[model samples]
Target: MTIAEHRTDTTHPLDPMTTAEVDAVREVLTRDGLLGEHVRFAYLGLREPGKRAVETFTGRADLDRRFLAILLDLGTGASRSVIVSTTRNTIDSTVDIDPATEGQPPIIDTEFELIEDILNADERWTAALAKRGLDPATVRAVPLSAGHYDEPGESGKRIVRSLGFQQFHEKDLPWAHPVDGLVAYVDLTGRRVTRIIDHHEYPVPQEQGNFDDPAFTGPARTTLKPIEISQPEGPSFTVEGSVVRWENWRLRLGFNEREGLTLHQLSFHDRPLLYRASIAEMVVPYADPSPVRFWQNYFDCGEYMFARYANSLELGCDCLGEIHYLDATVADDLGQPRTIRNAICMHEEDYGVLWKHTDLFSGTRETRRQRRLVISFFTTIGNYDYGFYWYLYLDGTIQLETKATGVTFTSAYPGADGAGFDYATEVAPGLGAPLHQHLFCARLDMTVDGDRNAVDEVEPERVPVGPGNPHGNAFRSRRIRLTSESVAGRLADNRAGRTWHILNPDKHNRFGQPVSYVLSPEGQPPLLADESSSIHARATFATKHLWVTRYAEEERYPAGDLVNQNPGGAGLPAWIAADRDIDGEDIVLWHSFGLTHVPRPEDWPVMPVDRAGFTLRPFGFFDRNPTLDVPSGGNGGHCAD
Candidate 1:
C-alpha cells in the first residue's frame, strides 16, 4: 500500500489523470460509501510519484497512480481529504477538515449557482437592490471567496461573499454597471444568506463596455497587411503522448485541475536541469480600502481552481504556425470526468538572433537566428484572462512570460464631474478601475546536474573609488551562499542587478566552476499590502521576491492546500519555520514576480496584453556558447522599396 499501484495504460509516472481514470476514482469512492448526497469533489488529481520513482521510471507498468481528492459536504459544512487507489479498489486514507481551524476546501463549480439561488430568493437582497433603483432580475450576482477576518458567525462557515452588477439585457456587459456598496454573505452549507452589508450607494456607470460589438468598435482598419507564418517542412519538434522533444530539450507536460500547465523531467541534451516547474499560486489583491472592497483578495489557483477554466485554444488566434495541441481532463463537482480539448498549445517561434558578429579585419559576417519551443495555455478567471507561456530556447535559456488581458474589473465611481477615488482610476465617466497587483509564484524544483543543489544570492555592486579602484567606474559581483531557509528569503533589487544561481557544488564545467543556471528577475514590487492586512498573512509567499527551501514532496503549493477559507500564516511562511539547512541538498526555488497594474484609459472596453515574468539562463552550466553549432539560416523574405 505504500507504493501507488501502477497501470499498464499510463506512459509516464507524472502523466495526469485521464477521463477514464477519473471515472474509476468516482466509482471507487462511491462503492466505499465515502461519497454522500451533498458531498462534492472540490479537488481531484493524480498523486505525484516520489522523486526516486520518477528518476528510476523506465516506461514500465510499475508506477504510482494514486489519486488525491478533496471532498466537501455542503449540507454539513464538513470537508475531507481522501486518497483512493483505483487499482486496489479501496480507500487509502481520509482526513476530516475542521473549517474553524484547518480551513475549508476549494469552492466548487456547483457552489457558484447555489450562491446565486440563495441570494436571488432572499427578500433582503432584493430590497437592497430596490433601494438602489434596480430590479432584482437585472442584477448578475458573482460569488466571491469570503476571506477570513474572524468575524462573528462567519469564523468557521463555508461562506461566499457576492457582489451584484446590473445588466439591462442578457448580453449587456455586467462589469460596467457594478451594484456598488452592497455585499451579500451567503453560507453555502446553510443554503441561506448569513448577512448583507449595505453602505452608501454609488451611481452605476452607464457606458457600454462591449468592445467586441460592431457598433462599439466601428469599422475595421484595412491598412495593415497580413503576415503569415508557416512551416512548410513541419515543426522541428516532436510529441509522443505527454513527452515532448525539440532539438536538445526534452520534457514532459502535466496538467491538473489546480495548476494548469506543468513541466516535469526537463532536460537539455539528456542532462537533467529541472525536475519540475509550474506556477504554484497566484493572488490578485485590490488596493481600494472602501467598505465593500476592503477585503478584496483572490487566490486564483488555490481557491477557484485556476486550470478548470482553461480556454480551448484556436488556430491563427491563440496559436500560429505549425502547432500541436494537448487535451486535459479533470473531474467536475459531481466527480464526473470532463475534458478540455486543445487546452495546451505547443509550437516554435523564431527570435531575432542567437549570436551575431562582424569581423572588420576579414570583412566577414556571422549570425545565427534564435528559435524557442513554446508551451503555453490560457485561463480566463472571472474578468481577467491570463496566458502562461514557457519558452525553451536553443541557447539553453528558459523563460516564462505571463500575459494578462481582458476587461478591467470595474466599480462605480463615487464622485461626479469625472473625478475618481484615490485608490481607483476613472477609466470611463463614472467607472472606476481599482488599482491591483497580480503576484505569481513559480515553483522550480531544481536538478541542475542531479538533485543536490545550492543557491547563491548574486548582486552586482559598484566598487568604492578609494579602495578597490582608483576610478569610480569599477564594479564587481557579490555572491553569497544561501545555506539555510531562514536567510534565503530575499528581495529583488533592480538597481543592484540581483539574481540567484542554482548550482551543483559537486559538478563543475570545463572552467572548474560549478555548473549552474541563474534566475534573472524582471524586478517588480512584491506584495504591496500592509503587513497588518489579513491578505499579507495569508499570501506571505508574495511578500518576498525569492524563497529557497529544501525539496519536500508535500511542498507543492506556496499557499496551503485548503486555501479557500484559510486564515493566515500557512504555506511558505509555515514551512520555513523549521530553518532547515539547504546547502548542497536538493532544493526548490520559489520566485515571485508580477505587475502592479494602474489601469489607463486605453485599458477600458478590452485590455491589450500586459506581460510579466522571469528568465532562467545558463551561467556556468556550459563551458562556452552552447548554440555555436546552431546552423545559419534565413527565410529569405527580403523586401524592396
Candidate 2:
C-alpha cells in the first residue's frame, strides 16, 4: 500500500490536520504578521473540537477547522498561543504567554542544534572538555531540560542544561562514555552560556556499547526457523481515513505533535465506552542525587514532545500480517508540515481462546478462538524507544500496553566494583545506569452509555467471622462513589484488588446494576520522589494512581499545558482545587502506571523490551458474554506444525 498524503476532504471533526490544512495554518499566521526571524514555532497541532461539536458532527462542510500554534519569541523569552481558523484564513484569538510566570513553552527541534553550537563556541566549555583530556570534536554535547529548582539565576529564563559525552569515533555510542561532574546552563533566549559548573572530574568509561552490528557479534545464528504469519484474506479490520472498524469495535485515530496517537469515539456494538483516550503525559525521573545530576527529571511527552520524533514504521519489522499503515502530518519549527510515513500501524492478532465449554453429560464441546485489533505507534526519544499499543478484544476488553526498549542512559562509575552509589546499578564494566521511573499518565474521557456517568472505587475486602460469615472465608467487594474532585484522587491497593468503575447513572444491566466498564490497573507505586523535592510538586499527577474530575475542554493535559521548566502544582494538582462535582456528570479519568528501572548487566549495549499498561473490562455493561457469537475454528494447517 502506498503512503497517504494530505486530505482535501475533512470527514470527521476529530480527524487530524492534513498537510494542506497545516499549510493553510501557516498562511494565516504569515498574513497576520506573526512570522519573523525572532519568532519560532514551538508546537502546532489541530485544536480539538468541543465535545458538543464532535457529537453533533454529521460530515458537514461548514465544520470549523482550527489550528493551535504555539510561537516562541527567542529574543524576549516569551510565547504566544495563537488559534488560527483555516476556514476564515484568520487568527481567531491569541494569548500572550510570559515565561517568567506562565512557564516556558516546549523547545523546538532547531534549539537542540543551537545548544550544540553554543557549547562548541564557548571558550569555557571547551576548556572544561580539554581539562578532561577530551577534544571538542570527539564529544557530543546535548541539551536537557533545566528543571525548576528556584536557583539563583534560573528563575525567569529559557535555560537548558548541557552535558557532553566522549564520542572517541563517529560510530561509537556517546552514552557509553560520560564526562561527569561538568555542567553548563545555557540561556536560549540570550543565546549564551549563563554558567558552567564543573565539580571533581571522573574518568570516562572506555567500553564500546555497540551490539547491533554484524562485526560486534561475529556470526549470526542459523538454528531458528522462520515463523511467518499470513492472513490469506487480508486483515479483518476496515479503515476509512482515520476511522477504523473491526468486528463490533469502532474508533477514530488522531495524531499530533504532543500526544502521538489518540483514540476517539471508542465503541463496542455501537455503545459508547470511551469518548476519547490518549497517553496524556509521562515523566522519567532519575533517582541520583548527585550535585550535577540532581534535577534530572524529564517530562518526555510534555517537555520534549517525544511524539514529534515518531518512528516511520516498516512492515515485518515494527508490525506483521496484512498490516495497514496511516501516515501522520505534524509541523516543523518553521511552521511547515512534515509527514511521517507509516506512523500508525493497524492489524489483528489471534489470542488463544475467547470462550470454551464442555458438557460431560452430553459429550459435547464448544470453543471459540479470540482475536483483537491492534493500533500502535513507536517513538524514539534520545536513547529510549517506546511503543504505545492499544488493543481491542472481541470480548469488550480494551488495553493499552507500553513497550520500552533502547540503550540505557549511562553515567560514570566511581568505583571499579560499582559500590557506594546507592541510586545506580552498573550495567557495564564502568557504566552506571541510574535508577529511574517511567511514570505514564493516560487520559480517559468516558461515556459509558451516555454522558451522565459516575466513578466508583471498588475494592475486595476480607470478611470477618460473624453471623453473616460464620465460615470465616467469605469476602465481598465494596464500592464507593467518588462524588467530588477533592476525594477522587486515589491510590491502588493490590492486597484489596482495587479497581475503578465508570458507569452511567441512568443506565443499568439486566441484573439492575449500573452499566459500567472497570479499569484494571497494574498497581505500580506512584512517584517515589519525596514531598519536599521539586519533582514531587511538578509531577503531582503521578503521585496518585487514579484521579477523577469533571470533564472540561481545557483540562486535557495532566501535567498542565506548559511543562518545560514550570514549577509544581499546575496540571492535575492545580485543577482539582475547584473540587467540582464529578458523580453523575460528565467526568474524565486519569490513570498513572509505569516501571521503576534498576538496570542489570544484561541491559547494557541495548536493552530488551519492557512492558507496562492497564486494561478496561466490561463489568455490568453487558448482560451476557459479549463474544458468545464469535466464530469457533482453528487454522487448518496448524496440525502439521
Candidate 3:
C-alpha cells in the first residue's frame, strides 16, 4: 500500500491508534519489509498492560528495522505507547501511540510534549540521582595496619621504660634533662635529692665536690747554710750603730713589709772568699715602746732589703752559654750556612722566707680589731728549667737565702746608673746591635741589724769555680768600659767584644742579602765623677759563640761545635726544651718572684709585699719546622711547644 494509505488506516479513530502510531508503523514496515538490513530492538517503560504490549511487539518483530519501544500508562486508565524505529535518521526515537478516552484526547506526536511534561514534573528524579551520587557504593575504603593499635601509650616512653627504668616523674627535672621523654628517679633526702637516672647515652650523677681535690697544701720548707765572707786586707771597717764605712765602702738600710728588714752596702772582698757579706737589719715598732720590738724591726727590715738585692742579681743570664759562627766554613741541614740570630736559656731560682709576721692590727677606731699576717722571703735565679724553689718560715724571726747557677747576659748598662735603650736608637749606622756578650762579674753587699760598717769589714768569699760555671769561660774575662773621650776607641776595640759578624759570603743578612759585617757597642761609659768604684758591677764581654747566620739554602751544619766554643754558648738543659724551641728564632725570657702571707679577710686593702728580683732569658726562639705542612688533630692533641 502507499505510505499515505497505510498512515490513514492505522490512524483511524476506531483503530485506537494516534497519528504518531500510524507514522511509526508505516516507517517500520517500509524500512524492514521493503529493504533487507539487520537491526536490534528492546522495550522500556512503566509497568502496565500497555508496556507489556509494546515489549511483546518489540521482541517478536524479526524485521530488519530495530524497534526500541516505550510505554507510558497512568494508573487512571489512560495509556500511551511509543515505537522508535532505529532505521529512521531522526533526533528522537519516540513516537506516541495513545488514543483519547473519556475527557482526554489522543496525543499525536508526543515527543516534544513528553519533554515539556517532564520539565513540569516534580523533582523526584533529580533527588533520586543526587541520593545515588552520595551512596557509599560509589567509593572504596582502605584498611589500616594492625600494628598501629598495638601500644597503649606514646612510643618514646615505651622505649625508655624498656631500657632500665623503674619509676619516673616529670617534675623537678632540668628543661634539657636527658630523659625528656621520660624522667626516672632514684632516692631523695630532705632538700637534697640523692640521685637521678638519666636516660642519656652516658649518664652521670650530679653532686658537689666530685672533681675538686687539692694537689698541694701549705708552704714547702727547706734550708741552706748562711753565707759568710772574710774581709779584704786593704782596710778594716767596724759597725757603729747601723752605719758601716771604710774608704770607698758604704752601707745603708732598707725595709719591706713581707721580708720585714734588710741591710745594703758597698763592700770589698778578696778573690779567695767563697761567700759574700750580706747583712740584715730590722726595727720592730713597739706596741708599748719596747726596746726588743725596736731591735726586731731593725733585723726584719734589714733582712728584707738584703734578700731583694740578692734576688735581683741571681736570676740574670750571664753571657757564658753558647756562641754561633756564621762563617762560610759552616754548613746547615739545608746545605747552607744558616743565617738567623737566636738565643735561648732555661734557668731556675730558689726563694726562701726571711721572716713572717702573723700578728698585725686591722680595722678603724669604731670597728673591732683584726689580726693580719705578713711573710718575707729571699730568692735567687739560675739556669735549667727556669727553676723556682721556695721555702716558708712563719715563726716571727726566720732567715732564708737562695743560690743559683746559670748564664746571665749583661746589658751594656750594668751599673746603678745604667739603662737600656732601643737597639735602633742606641746603635750607630753601619753597626748592628751586639749579640753573644759574656757577663764577666756580678757582686752585691749589704748589712743587717743596722750594721753599716759590718758590710765594709765583711768580705765576700770567692765561690769555687765548677766545670760548667759561667766564670770559668775563657772569653768572659775581658772587660770594656764606655768613656766620652774614648767613645770611638772603645767602640772599635769592643767590636770583637760586643758585636757578631756574619762571615758566610752566600749567607743572607736580615735584609735578605749577603752579610759582610755586624757589630753592637756597650752603652756610653759613665763619667769619672759619676762612677762609683765600690758599687755593684756586672761586666759582659762580647763573645763569638752567640751569633747565628741566616742562609738561603737548607743544609745541616755543626751547630753543636759553634756553641761549645763560644762563651755563654752552652745550650740549655734538655728538660727546658720540653716547652720551647732552643734553635729557632731570637727571643728574650724574663721571670720574677714575690712574697706575701696567706690571705685573711681582714686585709681588705692588702699592703704591698716584698718582691724579690726578676730575670729574663730566651726560651723557645724560632719558628717551628718550615719544610713540612702538618695537619692539626681536630680538638685533641699535644699542645704547641
Candidate 4:
C-alpha cells in the first residue's frame, strides 16, 4: 500500500490510519494470539511503521505493510512492540522493553487522560494536593511541568516519572508562577502516588495576577481593519491528493506521527531533486546547571514527538493567502485513531523582491517581483510554540525556517544566591525563566537527478600573485569531493567563506557546471554543548553543520529513535562508526541549524515569534537567472483599489 493508502480519508495517502485500520490490526493480533490473556492491550497505534533500513525507494515492492502496535503487559510489567502484517493476517514479530518503567509514573501535567482525571474527579488527586498543604481551589492552573526520567534520585528501585509543579494564582494564566517549589512523583507502572515534594511550605501565592496583562501590554496593541489577501486568479500551486504541483516543482506532502511533515519525491523542472526531506530530529537542551535543569534537557522531536502536538491553526493568525489546511491522524494514548485538524497550512506569500536593478549606466532599470509557497506546521510543546516552514521559491531555491514563540519555561527561584544561573528576569513576582538552547536538525535526502550523489565542499580563497604576475585582486575557488562517509560530514565555517553542495556528477547545466544545490548557513552555529555532554553525544548529527552518510532509513533520527532517558548511544555517531562508502552512492545529508535563546523581559508572558533557519539555493542547477522574466509591476497594496 502507498503512504496515502489505508488512511480512512483516501483523499491523501499520508493521512492518519483510519479507526478501521486500527481495529483490523487488533483483530489480526488477536487471531494470531499476539495479545496475551494477562497482558493488557493498553495502546495500539500506527507506526508509519517502517521504510527500508536503506533506500527502499529503489525497490518499492520491498515495502512492508504492517500494523505497529504497542502494549502494556501487566502480567510481566513490561512494554511490548508488536508488528502484525496486515497483508498476511499474521504476527510478524513481538518485542518487549521498558520493564523498569512498567510501573513507573506518567508525565502528569501533559498526560491529557491523567489531567482530565485530576480536573474532574473529586478524589483521584485531592489527597496528593492536600499532602503538600495545598487546597484544590488554590490551584489556578496545573500543567505537566516535568523533565527527563532519571534512574537515580527519588525514583530509587522503582521506575518512576517525576514532575515539579508550577502553579499560577489567576484561574487562566497557569504559567504565571505565583506558587513555587512543589513536585509530584507517581508510579504509573502500579498507578499509585509516590510522593509530593513541597520544601518551601507556604500558602499558594494569591496575588491574582495576569502576566498577559492588557493594561501595559506591548505598546498598546492596535487592531487594524481586516485586510484580505486573495489570489483572484486562483493559487499558482495545486494539490492533487498528496501530490502538490507548482511552478517547476512537483512532490508529495506526507506526514507521520513520528515525523510531522515530509516532502517526498520532490523534483524541480521535472528533474528528480530529492526522494525525501524532513526534520529528522530536534534537540532543545536547556543550559541551567541545576540538578533538575541538568538532566532536564530533551530531544524535542524524539522524546516528545513534536509532530503529535501540531496545532489546529487559525486563518489570519497563522497564515494569509489562499491557505489549504492538511489534517494528520495518529493513535491516541489509548491507541485510538485521533485526527489533528489543520495541522499543516499551505499558502503563498509575497517575498519583497526576487531581483531588481536601478541602473545609472543607462536610464533603464528592471525589477523582478517574487512570491513563495510555504508548507508550514506549528506545534506547541509545553509553553513554547515552534513553527516549521519550508519555502518553495521562484528562483529554484528552497528555504527551511523555524519560528519560536509562546511563553517561556520558567523556574521558581532558589531562596538565595541567584548569581550565576540563567536567572533572566522576574517574569512573575518570585519566578525566573532561565535561558536555554533550541537545537534543530533537518535531514535532506538529496536525490539530485538520482540517488547517487556526492558532497562537494567549496571555500573562497585569495589567489597568490604568481601566474604571469597576476594582480592580487584575483580570488580563488577551492573544491573537494568527499571520498568516504567518515570524512564527508563537516561543520560550517563562515570565516572561511565555506559552502557545501550536494552534487550530481552525471548531470550538468549548459554552462558545464554540476547540477547541484548548496547548503548555505544563515548564521554562526551554537556550541555551548559539546561531545562530552550526553545530550550532544546522542545527537552527533549536530556535531557539524552538515553530515553526509549513505542512505539508511533506520538512521532517520540523528539522535536515535528512543531518546527519552537514553544517553548518548545508537544514533548518527554509531552509524558513522561503520564508516560506510559515501562517494557516488545514495547519500543522506543531515543539516543542523540552531539559535541560543537568552530570553529577556519582553519574552516573559509569551516570547515573540522570532525566526531563524537555513536555505538551499540552486547553485549550478540552472544556467542563468530563473526569475529574469518575472513581471516588475503589479501595484499591489493592502487591498485591491
Candidate 5:
C-alpha cells in the first residue's frame, strides 16, 4: 500500500487479541527474525507525529488487517519492545525468531495488533519519554551526512555508498587543508567549512609600546621639548639718543627718538578721552560739529549716532551714562589749535548734571560732578599701538575698566573639579549658594586728573537728594550700604594670598583716584563668623549709589534685588536682568579692555584704536568657589605636588 493508504488503515480500532491473533503474528515473525534492524516508516498524513512515533518505536511498520504490523528493531539483538501513541494505548512485542539463520520475515497480524495497542497509549508514550529525560516537543532531528555526488540523480547512490564505506570522496570529506596553509574543517552536517585552524609559527605584527609594555625611551622627537635661550645677561640696547616722544596715537611717551616729534603710545588709560567725547556729543544736541542735531533727535538716539558715525570718523553713543568720540587733528598735542571735530552727550540725568542751564551756551553747572567715562587712544611709537579705558564714577569714587589690546594674556576657566563645593545648603539649608570667588581677575593702573587740591580722603558718606533737596526734585537718594568686610578681605585671606590682589580693587587703584593703598599685608579674613546666614548676603550688599550698591535684584525702576541674586550682579547689565529666559543655556561673564598707559602717533590714522572683548563664563552663580583650587597654568607649579 502507498504511504497515504497505510496511515489511513492504521488509524482504525482493532478487537482484543485472541489465541489465533497471537499465533498468527508468532507464526509470521517467529519463523524469521523481523527485529534487530534500523528501519524507517514514512507517513503521508500527520507526517511529524508519525515520524515521532517511528522514532520512538525505533522500527518499521505497516498496516495490517485491523492494526498496524510493526517490526521489532534492535538491529543487533532479538529484543522485546513497546510502542505508544497519542491515545494512551500501549503495544508490547517480542521477536522469538533468530535472524542469524532465517532471513527477516514480514510483520504479521499479532505483531501489528501488539504494536498498535502500545502506540494507542499516547499518555504512556509521553510518560515514557519524559521518564527517560526526553521532551518529545523539544526533540530535534539530526540529519545524516553523506558524501557528495557528481550528478544530482546519483545522490541516493552516493548515500548508499557512503553508508557502506567509512571514508568519503575528497570533495565530500567534510575537512580540508587550505592552499594558503590553513586547515579548514566542516561541521557534522558537511554543508560548509565551520572553522579554520591557524598553525603559523611566526607572530603577527603589533603596535609598538602597548599599555603592558609602555616605554618612553625613544629620541623624544614626537614630543615638544622646551628650548632654552640665554642672551648675554645685559641690557640689549643702550638708551643713548632715545628722545622720549609723546606718541599721540598710542597715548604713551616712548623713549625711542626715531621721529623728532614726541609721540604718546595711547594705552587703555588714555581711552577715556575718546569715550568721554563721544558720549558728550551723543547727549548734547549741539555737541557734534555736524549740523545733524535736529535729524539725530528725530531718530533713536543711539541709532542716529551709529548711522551718522559708526563707520565714519565720528563718534557712536549708547544709552548708558557715558560718551565716546573720535577726532583727527593736525595739531600735535592734546591742547592746541586742534580741529577736535568730536561729539559729546550723556544720559538724561548725567546730561542735566553736566549742563543744568537750559541755555545752550551756558557752561557746565557742576565741573566736579561724577561722570561715566569711556576713552580710546591710538598711537605709533614704532608700530601700531592702541588702548582704552572705561570709567564709572559715583559719589567721588571711580571704578575703571582698563584694557591694553594685543598685549593681554589669554586664559581659560578651570575644569569642573577645581571650583569649591556649594555652600548654599550649609548656609540656608535649602536655598542655593553664592559663588565662593570670582572666576577671573583683572589688573589695572590709572592716573587721575582732577582738582589736585581736592581732598583724596573725603570719607564718602551716603547723602540724600530729591525734590526738597537743593538740586531740584528730579532724582531721589538712598543711603549707601557698603559692607564693612569686602571681597578684598576674603581674597587676601585665601591661600593664594598676595597673588589674589587682582580681586581687591582697593589695592590696585584707590577708588579710581590716585592714592597710596596696597592689599593688606596680612592674608584675607573669614567672610562670615556664622555659616547659618545666607552666603549670598555675606558676599553682596544691597545699595543705591553706583559706587556702593547700584546693583538691583529686579528691573523695578528704583529699588529691587539683583538679577539672579548674583553678587555684583555677576557683571550683568541691569536691563538684561528683566528678561527671564535667554537663548544660551549658560550665563556668560564678560570683561574686556585695553592695556598699557602709553599713547603713540601711529594710532592716529585710526585714532583711539582700542581693544574690546567679552567672556562667556559658566554661571553656576549659585555654586561655591568655582576656582578655589584651580592651579594657574604657567608658573603655578609652586602649588603642585
Candidate 6:
C-alpha cells in the first residue's frame, strides 16, 4: 500500500510500499488468518514510531526505522484498526494491532471507480431506467458524483451517489447536460438503490436535441496564422532526479496525494528562498441558494482531493516546447501503486519582452531576450479543469497562476421564466444555471533566507492635506508589521494598496531594505456563502484575501484532513485562533484567489480558460536589477538609440 505525508515533515513515517512489499505484507497478514472476508486495504504506508530529539531528517537519516502501517476495513460488524508490521523482521511481529481499537469509518472513502462500477452493476439501475421509460441505447444513466453525509448525529461511513441521464446526441461537441435535478440515492454497501429523487423530469425540459442545435453552435469562420513557441536551442534547464536546476532557479519537485505538484527547497542563485510551497486548499461552493445547488458546496482540494485526480498529461494538448516531465507515485483506492506520468511539465516560454531601453538622443535601443520557465499541470473535476502554473522568470520573480477551463456545469431549464437570468445565462435553449465561484488558497511556506521570518503589509494612501500637503493628490506609504496571526487576515485593496509580504529580518539587500517577496492578489472574489453555512465553517480560509500564520507540521492543510466529510474546517482558522506570536517565526502565507463567473453565451460547449491567481515578486529580495547582466542586443534589428 502507498503512504503519503503532506508538507515538510521529516519524521513522518508514511512511506508507500512497492508491489513486492505489499505482497510480502499480504502474505504475512493472510498467513496470520487476520484477513477477514472484506480484506480491503484502507491505507498502507510507513509511520514514524516515536518522538525524536531532532525533527529534521539530515545527516541522522540512518536512525530512521521503517515500520509498515496498514489500515484495513474488514467484513461487516468488524472493527477497523491499524496493523503495524516491521518489514525488517516479518517473524518477529505478524500483526501488532491494539485489540481495543475499532475501525473508525472514514468520513467518505467511496472511490469514483468503485462507485461507478457498483452502480452500473446493480439490477435496480436497470429497473430505474425502465421506470423512466428510457431506452438503454439512446439514453444512458451517468454517475455525476458521490459524497458522504457529514451532518451532526450522522454516524458510520455512508456514501450516496448522484446520477443523471443524458441523451446520446451526435452533436460532435461536448453535449453533457444534466437531467433536471433528477438524483438517485443509493445504499452502496447494501447493493441497492433505496430511493430515486427524480422530479418526473421530461425531455422537453432538457435540451437533448438542442445539443446539436445551431443556436448553441455559433457560426465559426475564424482562421489565424499559427504562432508557435519553439525552443531552438533545446531547453535552458536541467533535471537530475526530482531536483531541477534552471538559469537561476533550483528546486526539488514533489507530488503528493493531497497537493499535486509542489516545489520544495526552492532556491535562486544558490540561495534558499522558500523551504516548501504548495496550494494549501481550495473550495468551489455555488451560490444558487436552492436546496440542490446551495448544498452543493465543494471543498475541491480538501474534499475531492485534486492530487489524486491529476491527469498523466498529453504531449501537445498539455504543454509544448523542449518539455521535461516529472513522474509521481500515487496510491489507488485499492492501495496500489498508480504511476502518474508527467505529472509536472517543465519548459520555457517567450513571455514577450523582458526589458527594453532606448536612448532617443542617439537613436539607440537595447533589448534583452524574454523567456520564462513554466512549471505547470492540469487537474480535472467533474466538468471543469484547473491548470496550476508556476512561472519562473530570470528577474528573480515567481508568478503563480491558475487557469480554469472545460465544460461549464450546465443545469436543466424548463425555459427561463426570466428568474435565473440575473445569476445564469442560457447558453442553449433550455439549459440555464447560475454562475458560481471557485476559491483557491495557496499555502506558501516562506523560508526567506531562514526560518525566522517577519510578515508585514505596505499600503499607499493619499495625503489628506493640511500643512503637510496643499494638494490632496500626494500619497504616503503606510507600513505595518504583523505581530500576530490574528492581525494577519486581510483583504486586498487596489486603491489603498492592500498588499502583504513576508520578509527576512536578518537578511537585507545592498539597499539596506529587508529581503522579502511581495504578494499581489489578482482577480479575487468576495465570499458569497453565509457565515452560518457549514461550508463557511470549513472554508474560513477563503473569507479573507490573505492570511499569515506560523509554520506548524500539523497545520499543512488550510482545510483539515477529513475534507470529504468535514463541515467545520479544522486547520488554519483553528490555528489562527491560537493567536500565536508570529512576529519572527517560520511564516506561512495563505493567499486566496478566485473567479466570480456569471455564465455568458460564449461559456457554452466549453468555457475559455479564465485565469486567476497572484504573483510573488521579489521586493527587496535582491539588490538592484537581478537581470542586470541580461544581454542588451536587439532581435537582429537596428538599435533605437
Number of the top candidate by lDDT? 1
Give the winner by TM-score: 5 or 6. Answer: 6
**Per-residue lDDT value at 255 in model 6:** 67
For TM-score, candidate 4 versus 5, the one ahead is 4
Residue 387 lDDT (model 3)? 19
Tens-digit per-residue lDDT, 1-641, candidate 3:
33332222221111111233324443554443421221111112111122113224433232222222323232222222343342242213444432211111111121212221232131432233233332222211111001111123321110111011111222211111111111221110011111222222222112111111232222444575544322223223333433343322333222221121233332222111101222111111111111111111111211111122223212123211121111001111111122121111111111232222345476322211111111122332111011121211111111222222222111111112234332211121111111211111111121111111100001123445687566853334232221111121122223334432212223333555332212222322211111221111100111111212111011111111111001111122211223332122211110111221222222111112222221111111112211122112211232244
Expressed as tens digits, the lDDT of each residue in 1-641 for candidate 2 is 22223345776778888989988887778777887887888999899888987888777674888889999887787789999987667789999987766688997787888887899889999999889889888888878998898778888789999888888787788999988888899999888998888986888889888776677656889998987899997877899988899989889999987999999999999999999999999999999888888989999988988999999999988998889999999988888889999999998898887777899799867777888889999999998999999999988999999999998888877665424578888876667899999999999999998988999999988999999999899988898999999999999989889999989989988889899999999998899999999999889999999999898998988989999888878889888999999989999999999999988888888999999999999998999988766655644332121
524 Cα displacement, candidate 3 (Å): 21
Using alpha carbons, what is the TM-score of model 1?
0.97
lDDT of 5 by residue, 1-641 (tens): 11111122122122122223323333333334432233211000010122123224432243223222323332322323222222222233433333222212222112222322232234533353354344434322111121121323322120111000011222221111001112222221122323333322111111121112225223435676654322233212121121111111123111100111111211222321110111110110111111111111100111111111111123232223223233222211111122323321211122113212234576532222223323333221111222223332222222332222221100011123434222211111111111221111121221112101101111223335754576644432222212311211122212322211012112223234222212122221222212332222212211100111112222111111111111222222333444432111111111111122222322211224343322111111113322233223211233234
Clashes of 2: 0
**Tens digit of per-residue lDDT, candidate 1, span 88-179:** 76789999988877777888888887766789899999998888889888889989998888678987888888999889897789998998
Give the Å error, residue 194, model 5: 82
Against the hidden reference, what TM-scores do the models get?
Answer: 0.97, 0.97, 0.14, 0.84, 0.16, 0.83
User: What shift in Å separates residue 105 of candidate 4 from its native position after superposition?
Assistant: 13
> Which runs of model 5 end up more than 4 angstroms from their true locations?
1-313, 317-340, 343-385, 404-641
Q: What stretches of model 4 exceed 4 Å from their correct place?
A: 1-19, 30-64, 73-77, 87-89, 98-150, 153-161, 166-170, 178-186, 192-225, 359-364, 414-424, 464-471, 634-641
lDDT of 4 by residue, 354-382 (tens): 77777898876766667888999998887
- Per-model lDDT: 0.89, 0.88, 0.21, 0.66, 0.21, 0.65
TM-score of candidate 6 relative to the true fold: 0.83
Question: Candidate 2 lDDT (Cα, whole model)?
Answer: 0.88
